[model samples]
Target: MPASDDVVSHRAGLLRAPDGEALPQRVVASWQRSADYGVDLETVEPVFSGTPVTDSLFAECGQEVLSGLHRTLENEPISLMLTDADGLVLGRLSGDTSLLRALDAVHLAPGFAFSEREAGTNGLGLALADRVPSVVRAEEHYSLSLCTYTCAAVPVLDPVSGRLEGAVNITTWSRSNSDLLLALAQSAASNTSALMLARSQGRRPRPAPRGEVVRVESARLEPGSGTAHELGEAWSDAVGRAAHALAAGRVVAAVGEAGSGRATLLAQALRRARPHDRILSAAAPPPADVETWLALWAPEVGKPHTGVIVRDVDVLPAWSAPALRSLLVGRPSGAGPVGGAVVGLGGGRPGGTTAGDHPASGAGWAVTAESANALPAELAPLVDVVVEVAPLRDRVEDVMRLAEHVAHRARGRAIEFTPTARRALESCPWPGNVEQLVRAVRHAVSRTNVVDVAHLPAEVLSGSSRALTRIEAFERDEIVRCLTRPGATMKDAAAELGMSRATVYRKLGYYDLQVLRD
Candidate 1:
């Protein structure tokens, strides 16, 4: 049954539902989150973020999807909207004058932030919040002012990387019958992601004329088993593959998303092959300094026993590629040294052997990129092998291990995280990858002794949809152990942990655990 306005008001006034009635669990969670965000229930005064959506890939693709959907519903009293991942409205399309006025009156037009943090619990906000399809109708909305409308929304993710890009939202009058709103929103969101993926796959990066270069300091050995063998099978497999390539003196490229430690993986492989190898790491330079940058690093490439790793070679300028290619593999077919005094030679070989004469010859060469296909066209032909580093999200088993490693190194002691805290860390999509995880762990350790869920940053608690981690399993086990004790009641178990009965019930549902009761 639909909740009445009076019931919603009563529930909003107190954090509890009216007698003989129950609110949706998701709605309850959103209400708690909205209250945490300090949203005003009496009005929906969304803040204007003033962020433009021009030329944004998400906005572009989303607009195309929404436009087609809008045409199908042009005569209907509906508004189709697109918002960035942050819930800042990017575009809104509606032919119905009444719906437009209503949306405008609530500041739901473009440039306004209707995120849960800004406009309380609504369809788009909840979809973005949970990275799922959501529906909020009439009195189910947290804000009283939104009680006159129904909204359904679905989060759009990057098809290639599974990163949250934005959302597709559909809004209509509260009295309207729109059972298919959620399905429509889901289809639109999927189409947007598919378009983005297609465009990304079809686009080829063109190298420009200029670029800059800077030498990177020695790689910091990460905490715990910085050695590849111990991190997990994924890391081990990548390092092993790169090591094989380096051992044969093949030009290798470590390809994966940024912050997935591609360069580090290559460096570790190189070190494994030649313990005393001197590795020179350089960030692909800016356009203006391509020539000088080439000149500066050309000598190091020719030095014996030295390995060279160019980070993000995918960004190398078009003009720089031929020169760099020449430096790494000698002069291009007919051309003389591409850069001044930058002749390609058999340098960096062990035992002073000519690199051309043997398989295990020449200075070790490697590069890093977001993907192998993203590398510059000029250098692509020279790459003999490509090693892929899996992102941290795919390496769930390594998250807790890595977190403990980071916390241990930072605090100089083993810091334990509560199971709930571990669940938060493990479930995060980790868009920033390992680098973000390190920062989050450091942030938690700096503030608290034993890391609890409360100590985790806000970002860690949201935007994740992965299955339960080992830590969450532990949490579930503890809950079952507590609940199954002889002659125990749910209230007693909640009291034992100093948790409210409501929280226990929420966790039970979250874990999909059923209580055996008399």
Candidate 2:
């Protein structure tokens, strides 16, 4: 159900994030995600900044673009930023010195990670996360600090890989006409992607020179899974297999513990397989129209380049399994499933032993597919290939790179991780995988500027005596343990803590411990 028009208008006038009932489901979902990331709606802190990148693959890809755009603006009060796929600032240009100072205060510089999780619902982050060009008007942003400005951003995709390589964002005071700004931002991003694709293909003719544009295309999607291995090996052999599966036009299943960055890898594959095609996304539990959505699958019947990517198919409902199978089953190559084009199944526990069975080589292969592993039995046979992503604990050396990645994302700027701090980070156990690491790093960045070992969360560095986190951890633990006791209640716990019930619940919500209570 939708909100009343009067209620919607009131919220819109106040520049508040509309209640879930008032906004589109996707928009509400994004807002919920923002809150979960701990973004403060009232006080927008510049704790999250972007990180700097060396002269590398993307460093030169979109060079001089900002300067040229600035020239065209001719001293207009605007700022332009080019960021890598992670929202890490790569290049930035500003026309007005005053506006420049204001943006700098918010860490909107080259090399900061402006990802949605870090910066709340802003242009660059939303564009990258949703993979669509967008405009964020004043107060539309989750953070109050960004309310005075309007921004438009578009994701820049790798021509060959179809991966989200970066994004281009144009920012101005909220009073400006954003419709024009959005078009300009999209044009800028398109031009940048074209430049990158030209280099990758070596055709160099410009003007969509390859005659095809690509995005989210990668078998080697993302920066492999970590940086501690060879090439600081970000990708494990499983990723290579996943890539192979996509290229082979096989039904690819990427299984791993949650937060292993499987989506990042598969999204790249989707791009490579489709190149010129648009992908319609459906989740497990199969949306009501999923069959209908999948039925119109033909790239030759005026739909020459569209595909279906049903996520988390491992848990695909039993009833819908046959429907999906019948829709895909086996339709010969180039019919609908080409370049691993038909569908991509993401997430589900791997089969067999807990990756303990396969024994990871330095490249970090998590598992080998067998007859009875973690994947659902019915869906397994339908899947043509499988790639496993190992947990962060298995790839211990990669923690620092992962931390830096998160820090750049949360802080929206660069913060060096000292060798000593790196060792401290690597020593901890990451039980929640990437999600745990991201939360810990975001907490640390919010608390300190340097990101030293001392800056990390107390939970991350267990058995270490840090007066503040130690006390907080001890108190929270005691509270949780007591609350979980048989017949325990919030009233009893609040009395024991010598605080009001409201304060107790506030702290519970703050620490995400509300679930511990009845």
Candidate 3:
């Protein structure tokens, strides 16, 4: 465990004996278990006869992560490992062909089992066994063949189930910097988990020939490649930060325009952070007392981390606003956060309209809802923190990704978007945000074989600047120009506009510009 490679290697070797005091107690126990399992330190690389249970979304997403990590590993003597819950090496990506060939000689490829029970004391194996991020260097590995390597690994948990799915690991020569190795592993694992969570939430790409591939995209996607998972980078980051606060029992305030998925984000994060707690969902109402609201869960619900979610605080009455605000924002600095309540103040209405009348206590954390980017002074005092749930227009890549994800769920097959379809989608403002996208995709899927321009809702296409033909806009513009010019005569305008007087009159009439035509 010493910082020096030589010292750490010596310690690892010492751990091989019964009297080794250098290893952590848990690690020593793992080594003893490995020995009891009759592990062969010389040549124990277990190969699987069939596919692993992790071959589903977890494996797909893991491969996607490893493939992205290859950019860092390209032509280097390093390998990124994607192992299943059982510690099987389900996917491997490395740009160093020579190094990959060397690993293959040792059976460290796909379908190989490198579990703690199988490979013994390796980073990926121990990470799975211990359900924690880990690092293992030269000689730490119980297998002698792996003594020349250093590995850093972090477990990938199912976003919904919150169970071990697999691990993302970086493996390199023992000389590699352990800090950087662990950092990269943690980052990759987090990205993979976020993507996997999206896929689990019915956001799968159209099933590919091989099935749902959840690769983290590092660049703009090439033509014909579908984006697998997205909610925008900012939203994903916000979710992580908010979830972290929730884990520490902080009251989270989620602010977004109506239909932007503020409630969904809060709910999912709550479930993830406190899986055992009961979720008491409610729309903002004129509650008589804040204490009664907090303790309203059914008796059958058994958990210490239970909390309430005020779905739309914008709807709360003026009488209740002060009480709710005091409950969330009026506590003293030493007071505890709301019993884990995550209040989402809905947007669009004047700030004074929702949770406005409460006197500021300057004590607790509050979530300020910014529906129209306006933090009303009345409700402003209610927030200690503000998290914006970005609307769909701001994240167009996520639009296409979501469209494909929803389309697949509706159609039960893989479907690609046409360039025009994608363009139209990107241009739309998505006034209803995610809710609108869902309805629109469901509508398109129900009626069409493919999601094309024609299949898209007329309203969405109308909102898309590119959806209109050049000629259509040009004609409309020309008619408006000639008709609206100061004191312009229709007769002169028609001649210059290249239309007969009668045709110009008719066109103006058709466009409801008769008032201007005269």
Candidate 4:
């Protein structure tokens, strides 16, 4: 289908679309955003940004995935593309000379940025923008020049961390059959992400410490709204488990997503049982300084009133594992001085004594990581119990309570969220978990007396839910867009959604979209 008069008029800054002829809500939203960005409707001149990412892990893995896909579509006039998180085109592969030339004309070749901010609303841009798989068909593109092509793209995320790495885009002529384009793009993107994860797991990234020892502040321990009783059973249960394990002189590892309160859970547990214990925290240092970093802290770990929490033990070098093992498990008799001049953490004198010289049980030990499986092999055996901190999304009921708690802490009083803001918070996937919620609430409270939808971060408003599949996200967005439109009624929304009024009403409640109206 060619560009409709409605689309042409909408592109010219007229938001009106014929009631029955309205475009997909995602496309309409993108068009509005493009206008807001000052994108030219007549052309799409994507900015030439960074140099091509030819040597990086993402590019290497992406190239391999695209290469295999290219062979499958050998004679097809389609192009496969890879872009960085910023939507800078890193690589492109295609056998169709005509399509290649046309792509180059629109600055779709390597080293140009096709992000919505740079190029306008297109497949790769929308995927990167929303961090979801996207399909932009003819006339759906914000830029008129891009309307000649149909594009399917899927954002690639770090398999372990869930960070957006980039996107895989497949493009063909506007009239080409695109029934399988999105699935193909999704598969290639998933494979590229898997390969990246596999390569990274083979060799752990270098550990970079955030600095030195930090005394877990007593201020954080003071009663707040995010107290044990209020944070839900899941949270309280994890803290209880850690406290029990630590009180029994057992090494505990708090495992979960990076910011899901792994350290907070362990620290809260300690404050409850041993408030007088000096809880010191430090992150794993660089590979070269591992020995020195360990040596500096080894002396404190042997004391009766001291407790230690090492962050990101997953990144510790393989060679330094045994030294860390010695710290937690104690040094064997006749073994060389651990870390060379470091006193034995297993409760021994500086001169070098057996594991029995001093009971290593006096001080508490714990570490935090993404999971128990991520811990170093040498140190894994030393962890007596693993306390799993559930990600924020798992406990949606806790979001508002935690938000209230975080806001009070930020403002030194109280701040509240509007119904719309609360729904946005509750429905979000919260990839950064509790830590992110705290930061967002703090940020919002600092700017406003009452947190509203406008005060929240952009990611929170537009974030894709991890629990929702790509198709579900598309449907959810459609329902939300239709229901939330000004002057839209149930009959109109149901008609727009192609569902019965009853079905639309049921789905509206199911998606927690009532807040969209408030």
TM-score of each: 0.47, 0.43, 0.37, 0.50
Candidate 4: deviation at residue 219, Å? 6.8
Clashing pairs in 4: none
Error of 3 at 451 (Å): 37
lDDT of each: 0.71, 0.56, 0.60, 0.72
lDDT of 3 by residue, 1-518 (tens): 11233433455565552235466544554554456456775766675746655558777777787787787568877889888877778777777787788778767777888886677678887777656678887767777788777889898876643445788888888878888999999999988977775654232222111111111122222111232335678667766766665665455567776657676676556555655544544543222233344334223122234444555454332223434544444433223222222233332222221233322221112342444234322344334344677887777768887888889977888677767667767777876687788888888788777666556655455442222234554565576566544566778788779999899877655544423444
> Which portions of model 4 miss their true places by more than 4 Å?
1-212, 216-229, 286-289, 332-361, 463-518
Model 1 Cα displacement at 101 (Å)? 37
lDDT of 1 by residue, 282-355 (tens): 76554446567778777766667777777877654333565666677665522422211111122232221133
Residue pairs in steric clash, candidate 3?
A: 253-367, 366-384
lDDT of candidate model 1 versus the reference: 0.71
- RMSD of every candidate to native, in Å, equals 21.8, 22.4, 20.6, 21.5
lDDT by residue (1-518, candidate 2, tens digit) is: 22333433455455433343344333443454466566666544534443566465455656556567778895888888887777777777776888989888887776566776677778787776666677787767767788789989887766643434777888999989888999888778777766665544231121221211122133233223222233135454555656555555455666666556565456545454445444433433223343454444322122334334444544332224444443443332212212211133353432322211211111111112211253433345445556666777777766777787778767788877766567657766565567678777887789778766556554554422222233466666656555544576789888887888898877666544423422
Assess the local accuracy of residue 434 in candidate 4 as a C-alpha lDDT between 0 and 100.
Answer: 82
Assess candidate 4 and give its lDDT.
0.72
How close to the true structure is residue 26 of candidate 2, measured as C-alpha lDDT?
Answer: 37
Sorted by TM-score (best first), the order is 4, 1, 2, 3
